[model samples]
Target: MSTQSVPVLAANDAASYLDLGITLALNNWPALTLAVQSNWGGPTSDDKRAWLCGAISEMLTERPETDAEDLEDVLIQVMNDEFDVVIDDESAAIVAVEIMEMKQHTDRGNFTEIQAMWEAYQLKSQQKSASAAMFKKVDAKDEDQETDDESDEEGEDVEMGDAPALVRAPREKAEPEIDDDGFTMVKKKR
Candidate 1:
């Protein structure tokens, strides 16, 4: 009979996995994704998101007894500080709860949730890339059509009618009166 022993996860390894789970969870977060995609945290929005993941992981690891409420507060504060966003829709709370669950699961060496999140993120990225490609193709076609139209227009002489001459009423020049405060004062025209 052959006996096989399951590999045990070490403390450091578990912490690494927890960090990975936190990163995956943050990446899949719609609010953070949108903020990064839209450059909400300036040009380095992506970097900000990465920093946020690190911060969350560090907080969880350092404070093992941290609850979801604490996590939610961190999320809200970071969003406001880094992305200049105010999250009042309770999405931060939801993300915090998810992260807490991920932390618990990862601590126990169960990475099923993380794996599923990774797969979903990959699928979403692929779909976004496909959509961008399609948009580019359509845009390229539009540019080609515009170029053809411009070429056609270049082959013909365009007749532009004479524009109407602008007419203006002549105004009488008025001398400005100076006040004691060295300010120019003007009387209303009668």
Candidate 2:
């Protein structure tokens, strides 16, 4: 006997899209913010548009049945009804395409793959942040080496170390690295 293949989303899934999208947005806020900041190399307006679109796209993908048009529809609804921000269909469509590209990177029903991808993304982002901090420390050391003759005298004025220009809020826990084969390895405390 042969069986017909059905789409992954059911009627319940359709009903859950909005709520699920909201949950996904809230839960992934940090990652989403990083994505928006890192991906934008454009003007403020364009970057906001792209960021909103990408967020909507990411939200819809969680429901399994949404597509590019649905992405635009959600964005339009949010902008007009929810936020009172006006946007035309053409602009929405452009934003939708940008986000849909992210979804198309993964196959359907392979959520583990998507999770691993995110783990890798988060891991690399943290690494970049660490290296940037290291470079800043080195730069600070370099700046300290310009000695002055008068400053060396006992009666001369002495200045304490300057406060860092870039302040980093401490992270609670480090993200585990995902292996090349898509497995996240956590370090267990012994």
Candidate 3:
């Protein structure tokens, strides 16, 4: 993604960038152990300097505004640059100022925004599922009542009346029960 001329990465993908801190020291930063240890590159003192220079150059091309005073500065800027691309510091150090493999990345601003949107999407999705579940339960209850009504049709012969039947149920009469230990029990009917 592109934002303000800097490429943006999805927030989820960009979390790795934060994990790989720009200041973390690579093998060559301390000494040229590769050439001397494994009989590979980083053999000479100059070779060590070359590796540092190459890393610096990689940082420069990726971020043009990355003006640095020395090797340390380059590392800092590249690690923090918004372009998200850089020299693969995770790779072996060559003791010469040469180009390294470029690793691309997203800027921080875009990543934060994308992360927020992802959270909102998840919340809305949850709410919709809950509402759907509630409606399903109501519909299931209605279907059950309809099945009971169909079975009762065979038992009764309902004679048509002059007036339409009231849809409302007859209200039960309110009565108070006397339990004072001095009254006889009685029942009433209407």
Give the best candidate by TM-score.
Answer: 1
Residue-pair clashes, model 2: 0
Q: What lDDT score belongs to each candidate, Candidate 1 first?
A: 0.82, 0.51, 0.42
Cα miss at 9, model 1 (Å)? 13
- Model 3, 1-190: lDDT tens digits are 1111223444455433322222122322433333324433323533433444445545555665543234344544433342223445633233122112122232432334333443554576688789999999999999998988978786788987699766988888766577799675577765
* Colliding residue pairs in candidate 2: none
Q: Pick the candidate with the highest lDDT.
A: 1
Order the candidates by TM-score, highest first — what do you get?
A: 1, 2, 3
Candidate 2 per-residue lDDT over residues 65-91, each given as its tens digit: 777788778766655643345565376
Q: What is the C-alpha RMSD of each candidate to the true structure, in Å?
A: 8.3, 26.0, 24.0
lDDT by residue (62-107, candidate 1, tens digit) is 8989999999999999999999999999999999999899888877
**Candidate 2 lDDT:** 0.51
Least lDDT summed over 10 consecutive residues: which range in candidate 1?
1-10
Listed in order, each prediction's TM-score against the native is: 0.73, 0.34, 0.29
